[model samples]
Target: MYSSRNMCLKWLLLLLIAVAGGAVAAASSAVRRDGGVTYDRRSLIIAGRRKLLFSGSIHYPRSTPDMWTSLIAKAKEGGLNTIDTYVFWNVHEPQPGQYDFSGRADIVRFIKEIQAQGLYTILRIGPFIQAEWTYGGLPFWLREVPGIVFRTDNEPYKFYMQNFTTKIVDLMKSEKLFASQGGPIVLSQIENEYQNVEKAFNEAGARYVLWAAKMAVGLNTGVPWVMCKQDDAPDPVINACNGRSCAETFVGPNSPNKPAIWTENWTHLYDLYGNATRIYKPEYIAYQVALFIAKLNGSFINYYMYHGGTNFGRTTSAFTLTSYYDPAPLDEYGLINEPLWGHLRELHAAVQNCSDTLLYGQQTNYSLGPLQRAYVYSGDERKCAAFLVNADRNNTDIKFQNRTYRLPAESISILPDCNIVSFNTAKVAAKCTERIRVPTMKFDSPMLWQEWREVIPVFDSTTLRSNLLLEQMNTTKDTSDYLWYTAEYEVPADAKAEIKIGSRGHVLRAYINGRLVGSAHGYFRNFSFTLDTTVLFHRGVNTISLLSIMVGMPDSGAYLESRAAGLVNVNVLGNQGSKNLTDKYPWGYQVGLVGERVQIYSMNGSSKVPWSKYTISPNQLTWYKAIFDAPGGSDPVAINLNSMRKGQVWINGQGIGRYWISFPKPDGMPSQTWLHIPRSFLKPRGNMLVLFEEEMGNPLGISIGTVYLKKLCNRYNSYPFLGFSSTRRS
Candidate 1:
């Protein structure tokens, strides 16, 4: 038997040991409260360690929800650690007080998907996202708001801005989406490239930026907030660089305490209507990346677009085509655009391998000669990395630290270790480039198109009268794009008459006595024109009707509200006398085509409507409907609209988009005629394609086709995910 004192002593010792073990376990399991996301002047600290983050922009609304996972996964496989996207205000709240977050607008689902893939997210909540979206991502209804001025220090604008921003923040907080709440979102962005046009707004713009920064900070989301392209961004709000190459030198008026982050590294330029596609070489992009990492000591870099998807509906602006195919790593169809994708993957890996050294090491740069330079990053005694760059057009041999490196023209050599070259921008690995081809298909059954005439309303006594020509936007309030102008004139026997009209409308069609006459449109802006047409008229009252159509609203300008459309003045000149009919005579007005009011786009909806088998020539307003079998398979379908003139298309009652082939070709835009159809929207049979041709072209040539892949080049490139491979360059 042990003594009582000895027993007590043994118990005390055991208790001390248990407490010590508990303390050790607690220390091992403790996690950082900020979800391990922090930043300093050098780099972003993730999981309590400094890291070099490579992010890519993939807008949620541009793609389907079903596509979010695959797109994000592909981005990950391509060596991206983060995904970025813009939150479209117009898409969420198309009408004030009414909100939508379902379908393609489900931004929360998109962020969750990114998180599920173990990736970070950067939410760009730009209420004024000028991503070629209609009205610059601002609700058209905002124009209707009383005493409202956008993107400035206006009280009404700020009130709505705060409301929307608060709603988003509250929703994000409730879902615990911020990094501080153990979610995937590590950063938030407010305002886009406002600095570009800030000078126009002047002092108000400066005040608005400060207010925006303060508002963003007040949201209390435990993640860093950024203001892209805003040079005057206040402290606590990081100012990010956006452009082709946002290297360290490009860091604008940003606070010195924040890490240098490139918000948008443009991989390719956005396509404009009537312009040919702009292609960015993969080799050059790789060189830019290597230079950014080596020369600029870049911490975090995000590609503007990893996947540039379709711009469905009326979302296209700046005269851009419906296809938002921005020649990115992933094509518009979501397939890997190889050589570019693989090459970038290799470059990402090379950078990631030296992430520690790049983030924490002391960087030293040396200029060997003109356009030839070397960068060395020394983390410690044993860990070091270097980059040998030759930016000249000719190949050069660079001697660095007793080693001669053959640098190719405008290329970069990445040495993960200071000793050997892991990858070179000039030495491309073999990879298959995907070329999209539209395959010809023979329909099992011939497509039959039913035609209908859009009845033009005649003037009646009930027609509203206005003395002065009214602006279309103010008069119709965007109710419709079409407007009618009518007047009466007495035509004397054998009298020659001409109608002189001054207008700012997009397209103008004049008709005398319900008969189609000549049509005229301004080359650029609205101008004065005289229409002379021979017509047999009695010595009594004659009817004159003119139709004006607007392509789209002006999205950018000062005092945009003052811009006017439609006939500003009208006069009739005859041998007998001249009449100023500006607002002297009663004018008849109509909002839209008859087919729009009747729902003629749908087969079931238009079953009661009479149809004609005969098709009309291009120029007159007409509706054409065709039924055909769906182009089967997983590949996306597109209708070649090259045969058709300017118009709008509907697929099974869903509006595809507006097409205007009549617009004059710009320098870079090619004559585009293909319109993409989402695979999810297609059915096996009884698929209908309805077109409301405003200005005509042949409808008989319209056909449906699937995009087929063709190998552009056979460049063998090794990816970390695909393992190492040795192959010859194409």
Candidate 2:
């Protein structure tokens, strides 16, 4: 009886043990299935724990695919754990119903490359990305959509925005790119800085933000969504702050429940055409980051452009220079910007050391003095971390917790143990300077040139019409930049006539009887100019042709379609009564320059076209071509357009960028003159350099050269601004 009772008890125990084992196995699977990222009020939680994320913005389209992996690896080595990028709508869907995702536009390949390096991604899928891109990254075709209003609660705009967003989200879903699908993408952004200008659209803007948040949440990507610079962002959409001093502002007023996330800590200012280079101090940037980590209870900080690559092609804003180098850690050529890069790396490391204490500890703040403060975070067992900040222009020593600490002006000091100072923003722990070695070509070896004439099309009575168009964009639809306004008027005798032209465009060149009269251009706005010249008008009729050129179309603002370009109105003041020729007489309109129609700059069908060996003066509109041996090796090339006036340069068949040497320099621009040319675009034997000189410039001074790293220098005087230097004659 005792043996039977013992056997029954053993079987019961065995059955209970089997059931517990199965239950444990099921819980493990459930945890694995719930893999993804989430955030609390304190920090971002990943794998069921808080994670410290340092991300950098490196737009995939800005740099080549071959450079993506190396750039990302460099970022990771610099202690970055995530890569942030914006999905450029203009590059992907250039035309309606057509898409291109190959080569530089292959965003999937870029994200996968980031994942391969074990780095997370912040997908800023803003269909309206305004990163100094042409038309602010909105497709040019959108202008044709009837009854369309951009970035507001408009049916047409919302329809297209939703379509594109859905398309992109579906693509990522198919590739399993979201974090929920065991992929690298952790955060997604919907709108970009919409709050700043939302008031312009009034009630529609508020409705648009709510609609966008709802639409983003509806996508169900299984990751938290962010609305950068949107203070009034609704629930489920995290409102992230932007700008240089984001830490000082925190996460704005409404979204206090969300974790503080700095979406864009501006490393440096963007370069504008005809402006001086803006240099930002590395120490200042370091201090900002350290202060942010010490003050804000957050886990993520992203640099606006850790690597501000080249604009390449016509992707740049109308007012922006060709080189999109924002004085970032990595320049346009993918070279390390020394102290800024290294110093920031050290700062990131120091912040990461105390991340745990910062995320989990209770925080206490104390005011040391005016513009000075101390913050302490204490965890379990009295383990503490501290941040000492001095925002004054002069250094100061302050006593905190019975210990004295010296803080540099406009700097922050991080104490991981609340005692030992592990890092200080003002100290130069890394290389403080960098020198660039640029290879100069022998001045004696001047490039030989061939010339071609751009035939100006004459508008006869047959093509003439009596109506001036409201704007160039509406008439030309952005197909060309040059527009000719030709009109004929009869004069009693040879008399002085004042040809008045009120133009909103950038440049205006006047011609009488096919002869150049005078030229005038505006600085930033439209201005009226009068040409008072003696004209030899024939008894029958005299021809007057006014050529108007647009630097770039209006890229932003409301009712951009209504903005006028070219001659708004023209008036002729002579011995007779002044006549208003604003859409009155037979005004002939020409779309583009004759050279563009013939593809003269591209060297296509050059064998059949007539060529001249004699060099012509740069006073008139002309096309200059030169055949020279390519600068050998893998070094990037740049043409010194120091002497060339305002125009465009083309290497082989690729258009480099627009050059405006005649434009007066804005304060802060360095005296340098070299336009960068990618090595991949050059050939070994024959390379064609074509210049469509508009105003006036000597092409003889043009030279080919290479750029290389020299040595480190102070942050205030980093290598002369990235684009063409103002110094003429190289």
Candidate 3:
């Protein structure tokens, strides 16, 4: 929820004209021209005083660079003076000593875009930011680092984390991006929501937080540093609260020396792939904000995701949806026609009208009735601001200042001058879009289907052979998601045997002697599963190949880095006898899917390999290619992956991440069937679409069309795929 910055927002004109957020303060001890940002017991010191600071999160990597300028502009228009973003370390330093800041990972460019918009910036530099990101935003290669233990007081972990954090701070200093350096950045945050997982690490976690605080403050950013979701964030490092409603629960800072700032007020809540979409009510959000500022004496407020963007590529954690559009005020496509957008814009403006009073006034409270209360901020020159609240489940009459008013249930009313009600949290002019009637899309007929060739991996020298079963992450170092475990074994007689595989997996697919067996996938709670599929084996040398797929890495919990993934154990059990495959290193391992090699997903690369007649065979590694013209409008494009099983997509050689349609949908609203493609990602004609299906899937139902905004990267750059040897029978 945000309103116009500089307070030019004048909505709800019938009630009263809202006051504008003043320009940057001249200069004082609190803030200096040469660049110094300080804070007192009340609020963050910006431009020499505690000004009205309204912020919202818009993670840069979550969206496109082409979309950044437009997204930030919308935040500005919606009354946001500040834009906060987390510097995802995984996006920056993807490898040890190897860093990338190009294209969408260009964070400096993103920050400059915010500066260009004339708004403040809050840089949340978390090497371990767990925003449902892949490996909690830690680079996949961190698990490969020797003597590494994540998030604790481990020396190796701290070394990498601090190194990256300093690199970012130095980068900001070099670019003059901090407010103290005459840049837009006013605050810097280190370590996000550590308290949530702190208890798991025990005293070591406690020590790590202190060290993180000291280390961050030592960076000398000239701005005060903060740690959200840390209760014991140490001296000098301001600890802020993060939750749905900070106004009702957040009392103040842990110490009297700090301001009561809300680092995260979630405007939307996201779920894993199978779960339904959920969000908060706009009116309730407003009421919470009113209570926050009026009752809790709240200072700064930030919406976690003012513009919830997509989890493009393979950036999400295990089982998380590719669509990270959390139903925030701004939809995933940056479309802002939703009622929550307009409603909150007005709400922010109304609260901002009383900013001056709250910042300088002495607070006073009184009981109007049962569960009814009033907070009066009496400031200088008899000027005042007041908030009337009814906390009961049912609306009740409250008398304040000799006037009787009916306060809406669980709502707050704001009076900028302690008189006329300029804004009431319960009374919104907009209608809820839930009850509206509208089809999800204006779909063009399914694109004309064409016959395409397919490729099935032939286990041979192209894959790595080992005498023993290798741990997944260590063997591949997370170079790719798919891994193959193939072994040739003797079977005494023609019989059925259970191929038991204990896989620390998101998915496991098996193939016996070039024939399909079956596949099993893990849910959100458990990514590890044991597969006991029975298959017939002729009395001879039979090849057993098991493919282990990781949806994403473990993001939270203690010692996540040390946790084992992939197929940990393999065996064959039958009435005749039981044979163990893992004990003697009896398998050959392939790091990634054969299609991933030779760039089979690419338009030009697909031609190198001969493709045969199409088959929608289940439990087979397959690739499908097609082309289509770009949709006409700027509306976001949608490609329905309903009929398809689990797989990945690529457009014009760009990987759009993986998809799994087999996961049954609970809510039944299209069931996350469509993968949204940005309009900018498409060309007018001949847009190459490629799919690497892992199982039985029909491309006939696969359609690329346009959907309105209403419903809503890459490793391996340095090293090319080794050698490619193909086995094709025509």
Candidate 4:
């Protein structure tokens, strides 16, 4: 492994390369500053004056429409003036030329709701957004487009990209959603994080960026355009920063005319499956924001997820948890995270109060020792603001303005009046609370089971032999996660043979002559593993059938768009004879599971399914359904999947997400036992709950539950008022 010093040096070299590249992109044109939304090096000028912006991201699809109003209101009350979101292309344009802007995919309505709440918006329209979404928010059908290449300067790719972007802009224009139209959206983004893989595309990547910038400019949306993480972003497109702390390394904007802005300061990493939940302390995150304002003069700061909602349906990419970001200030259910939420709200108000001075004031800096410094902003009429920082690990006192003040370790003190410490990153004065759960089976029922509409490959008598193993994504078009392939092995004499199937898998289950042989799944996305099990082979035409399942597809890397997702190869090893089956086909394949083809996940479509009332033992590749009434009242709801092994869940035809209760925890239990069920997806009666179990698990143990928080204590009330109460957010 490279040492920390080497890593730092590597980053320095990369930075130098980026700066040199930025200079080249700057030659085309300069950002047009004469507009309704302009920027100086220090601030974003809005309404004809420099303004400080506190923004938060709330992906509309992550939450239900019933939850949008409350979520937006919560963000606004948290002292945020702006809401940031990415338009999910896959969700919007499910099929070619078909649009779905209704329901949760409604970007216009989401924006109008932001406008209704008196907040601005930053709409990142990446037709190729890498938001840990399926296909990185790109429409899966685009892969089926003739002569198409995604995210680079391919003509075919550009056409659809421009088409979708123009569609969104036109829709917003029709609704008057741009700032130029006196709407909420003040900024627009095109293409996301292209620079990370630009090197792989070589010169074509560079050219593509230029074309994208020019195309975005041609749109004439009347708001500033942004290209996030693009150091070489073309002229007129403000290149922005995205990381944990912009202050640590942000040099400035790509050009002098553009204000340095942070597009996505991640609140915390999302839950990667199989890993325990991780957290970034409230004070720790606050310090990053405070340091950005104190040292970098960053006027616009947006949290990637101030409130991370659920990753409903099959939208989650790879093995990510259904709970998108559990460490966010707001939980997946949209409730406050207590101390963290409260602390940041306090920080927001403190910073907002000093906005005017920080925007127009003359800046001065002072160093009081190693990592101990002070920044003072002097504005009109002697009004001033200050930021006292202690970046060291130990508490220290510093004398500033001829007065001594104590600063905690790795903390920053924000003084809106320049003389008093109103907010400190190390302080958490909000009342503390702990969550309580009635996560019991409020409603439980014996579910009816059924065999798939079509026979499993092992049972098919008319199976044709094939040598070719098809790639998974290309065959399914991401419409379904399951693919079935059957291959024949001829054993001249009766013998014990080993059937080996190597797969580019999220999951793979193998069956030899109607007998369950073995199944294996990769813990990570696109993991390569083999399912090898020994079986007695009959002399004539023994059938080997394999089922490949994609838990989630790849969402990153330069060539993820073309990554294979199914059985790569298979072989039979026996003393009688050995042969490779992968070379045998003209492989025609089954598109997906019969249940999916029959649309069993939807209410109307499920009635057509043939169900058996007789109870069956827990088995692989099975379907089960139960009808139950919704829990009474409006509190948030969750379902306990502890009884089941692995499968996806759907309620009233709305998919919650896939669940794997078998992945062993330290206590030999599943990592996540209870999963969220949005209240909006629930109805008062006859809620249909469907499960497609891929492994042996008892469905009878499933139950309904409720999760709520109980206030524990308060300690800061007796202290003098340093800032407004952060709990006033509700």
Candidate 5:
């Protein structure tokens, strides 16, 4: 009797164990399926899960392949599960039909690095990405193509775009970087934020949008495609919102079967040209995020710049009226943007705690006030979550469900248990460092007494021996800033010494025997200026040298198509700047920099060029070479041209970047001083410097120094000033 009773108990225990095992398998299956989408809602479950997604945006060409690993690891530590990037077209193909993907242009290696970190990838392939990028990501070669207009259905434009897009897609496919192939990229974008400027394009714009969607769909990556800022995207494409408050931003009418997503939550504004503004505060950012999540039915949201990296070399875009890079959370030096980073991190953690309810459960809103609203999502009695958000900049306190919560000027509130407030936007206590890098006021050399020499005109009007007019962007193709428009003006036998020179606009420099007599640029209503060539013109075969510099081009507008660059409607005005001469005469036109065609810089690395002895009267056109060991280990090196004038700099033959020590802004500040030295733009052994100083200045005083964060400290309860935060005690 005892044996029979024990046998029955054992069988009962076995049955219970099998049931538990089956339940565990079912839960695991649900977690895996939650990541992707399906045709029917009944086939999928949204609630009862937690996700660990890491993300960062590192442009492939922004930094070299050597720097990719370290960058990816840094993102991982910052709690990123994904790496996001926009494929820049200009950097990929500067010249048409010439495909080069080696060195920093290696997008394949960039993704492989992200995959190496065991992280997912978000590929934002906007051939028209306006990340403050030059030419809006269109290659310079594209503009030169006959009858080709950008972002349209023009066959030439579409053909080129399709070619490059498919090339990149194929390259990634070969590397198996798409999720369907068991790789990193799970999301891809088409035509970034087009709806914002849709009216400008009209039907062609709508057709282009459809074309972009169809093209992307044709790639067949097995993952759903996304169209950011498109309120009317076609079916099967998930239209995502992009902006500071995308939570309330709606989906496109054409595609309604996908979940809502916030492609970009502007953590802070980008840097502007003038005085750099500080990023938004952490509490403010947190408040914004809370508001976005609470007000909208968003299933997923991504920061516009979770990590803003450096724009090394000429990678920075500056075509705007003034250079406004937009002071982002991360500065140009790639330093941590503290308080901002911390406050957001805390908010992310809080949101994560309730991810199950936020991602899966139904959202219900409660009106707290005129501008205040709250959202409650309950997965279970113990797993309920709540949020109170005030979008206004003014402070607001609301009473809800027998409890009162205070909302800061522009912030949010999070309640994990639904009944108790665990986090408040006005109450973030994270610490941050406040610091700035002061420009080197002085260098080792003197400010003045260094160099002076004039550029000899090798290709003057008589020297060229040809009469033609070259259009600025078209003929020269932006290879050089200066285009020589010269003609031999016959002075009347009974002539006054001065000749009145005039042009359609200003920005003309008069030169006789390569001497800079005078220079003029358009300032106000009048673009035409004067050049007193009283002694400039002579009898028989005289050369008139005009150096026209383009300040900035027409970036956008209907009139952009009509804007002209270089000397237009040029003529020499005589009789005390009255009578014009050589108005209709045939003029000789020569394109590009005098030094460029000569290969004066020798940019392709060979051997270190020798430095010439310091000249008492430095020649204006002569190139100067200086060698120095790369300013200690790993610290960024910069040359203080503050003492010198305008010139182009080359390190070990590679163009480090352009520098204008004296070209201060309208605000009376230098054009730019510090030249950031990236690890990729440097050489290990001996480093060389070559400068073509147009306006000769001090060369001996030019010194190379390192750029490092001056101070690293912590200030408590004030997060989100920059993009990072510190856990250090205040």
Candidate 6:
């Protein structure tokens, strides 16, 4: 009995020692909390030990709050220690004076979810983020404000920016959501990629940046403030890089000292021109991350899209109405791109293992070629990590240091322990299924016609009102796609009166008796052109309807600023289209569609729409309605609008997307064509299809179909995920 008691006491003492040691280590590992800032480091020198930190980005409005916890949980599983997000100004303050923080737009809830996952947060309050968002996330009302030049040192612009930024800062303070106040947000970003186009503004551009830095620093968020793409970032404002190869985009000219940060490591390029079908190789992306870490020093990395979510509702902006393509890994439907998710997870785990060496150590570079290079982050001579890169567009095998490495086209390689090959840039073996829309039925159903009439007198109203005559980009806003350019005309009988109309190059359907005479659109040309005079009268009250439709908005540099996206000049022509008609007439105008006032898609909807049954009719330019039960399951659904002309489609009052069937032949110019129906835009019951058809076509020919990714058979390598092996197939 004495011997047993003695043994038990010894065991108890050992357990107590272990517990105390762990407590000390944990206390030391407590993140370096200096003021409102936390260094994203690998270890805390409590007594002297190493730890790991993980992070991710969760744009609150990208997904609903209901999805926040699950999304953060997924990030945790993927070994993320932080959650980063850009606070969208448009989504938060949708209207002037009305601030919304509820629902999916709840920034606080989103950070709390990240905190719950034991993760830190990076709040990028760009207030001016250009994430392919509409108007670059600015309130539409700003456009209507007089003399407001955005991103410049104009009074109106600064006044609005200050008010909005202050509101956001105050809100965060109230919620104690900043790391400085024990909130999860450790870092806050001010102006977005301003330097990308700053050269256009000259001195004002430099001045605007200085003012932005001062403004952000003055907020006193108790955390570090960063500005991505700004090389001339002022003191105390850390400048970060953003791009596909951001690991190389240097900190702007006059700035140094602050830690280098890869603010947006674009895992996959976002979709453009409405294709949304391009799938990037997962192995390639993993290699990119590994290579970024190896090449980029100072140890801060953030994936632009850790999980690319759906662009629900009207949030999906387009260069044209039909440009809905995003080549992101997670796709718009929230589907986990298998090999991408898996391969990246492995890469993250590998990075975590070398966190200590990468975070605190200095990296030295060794050259191979412009594309191929090496980065060694060393603590001790033998204890080091190496990264080999081959960003070559073509495949090449390099024998380096007595080890053979096969480099695929556009890839990077990571060597954690110098001798062992852990990850390669080219070896992703997953076969990307190029999804095609297959016709389920052998023959398309019979057709029904519809006759529609244009409200011709729409352009002849006395009160010609535009949201603002000449509003600036991201300012005057997107309240009305149509701008009323009212001018009257006097038709001379012998003068051969003709109306030559020119617009910003969009759909312009003209009318005489309010009867549709002819239409001109910019889709076929950079700008639209038309001439008509058939409905001439003896100089009486003549009305003309010029429906100007906004195909999409402009997104680019300063020259695009003055390029004019709507109607530029209109003239009255006579004498066989070569002569001029009455030079002057007071024209009236209206903006947007006639149906916008009825809240056609709103739930508290006033109009009772009958969508369930189908009817046959000969209608030109008419609104067609159809209702069908949603096909069960989570697979994506697409409406084959091959038979339909140009129109806007709504599923359950939610815009499934726009459809334009006119495929421009190989004219050597891009055109608006094709349509995609995302499953996220579907509804189980009362699934409505509202189409504002521009031409006469059979709506009955339209049918909803499923788009499935077909398995691809590779004939090259015998790899399963990438290439297929056929040697053993009998």
- lDDT tens readout by residue for model 5, 536-638: 4555556566766543333332212334555544455555344343444656666755455655556452223333456556555556655555555665455
Listed per model in order, the count of residue pairs whose N, CA or C atoms clash below 3 Å is 17, 14, 10, 4, 40, 44
lDDT of 6 by residue, 471-574 (tens): 21232246544443444444545343556665555566666555566676654225445544454534554555556665555443443324355444555545
Q: Per-candidate RMSD vs. true structure?
A: 12.4, 11.8, 12.2, 6.3, 12.7, 12.8
lDDT of 6 at 246: 56
Sort order, lDDT high to low: 4, 3, 2, 1, 5, 6
Using TM-score, give the best candidate's number: 4
Off by over 4 Å in 3: 1-35, 432-463, 613-619, 668-671, 709-730
Best by lDDT: 4
Q: In candidate 3, what are the lDDT values of residues 501-563, reduced to their tens digit?
A: 887877888888877788887778777788888999989888777778887766776777877
Q: What's model 5's TM-score? A: 0.80
Give the higher-lDDT candidate: 1 or 5.
1
What digit string (tens of lDDT, one per residue) describes model 4 on residues 1-730? 4568755754454454445545323422333343356556777666667778999999999998989999999888888999999999889888888999999988888999999999999999986888888879888888877888777878989999999999999999899888777888888899998889887886667767877877777787777788988986766678888987677756568777677789998887776667555566677678888888877778889998988888888888888778887657777888877777788899999998888888888888888778788888999999999999887777889998888889887788998987889999988888766665575453334443343323576424424334477788987788888878876666677899887888888788777777778888887743888888888988888777678888787888786667888988887787877877787554446767778877787887787778776255666777777777887777889988888888888998889988877776454646666778988888888788888888887776777878788877765343212221221110
**Which scores greater on TM-score, model 1 or model 4?**
4
TM-score (all chains, Cα) for each model: 0.87, 0.88, 0.89, 0.90, 0.80, 0.77
Q: 465, model 1: CA deviation in Å?
A: 4.8
lDDT of each: 0.73, 0.74, 0.75, 0.78, 0.59, 0.59
- The 10-residue segment of model 1 with minimum total lDDT is 721-730
**219-333, model 2: which lDDT tens digit per residue?**
8787778888888666657788888776666554254446778889888777665556666567767766776776777568899898888766556765567667647888776
lDDT comparing candidate 6 with the true structure: 0.59
TM-score of 2: 0.88
Clashing residue pairs found in predicted model 4:
467-582, 467-584, 467-585, 468-585
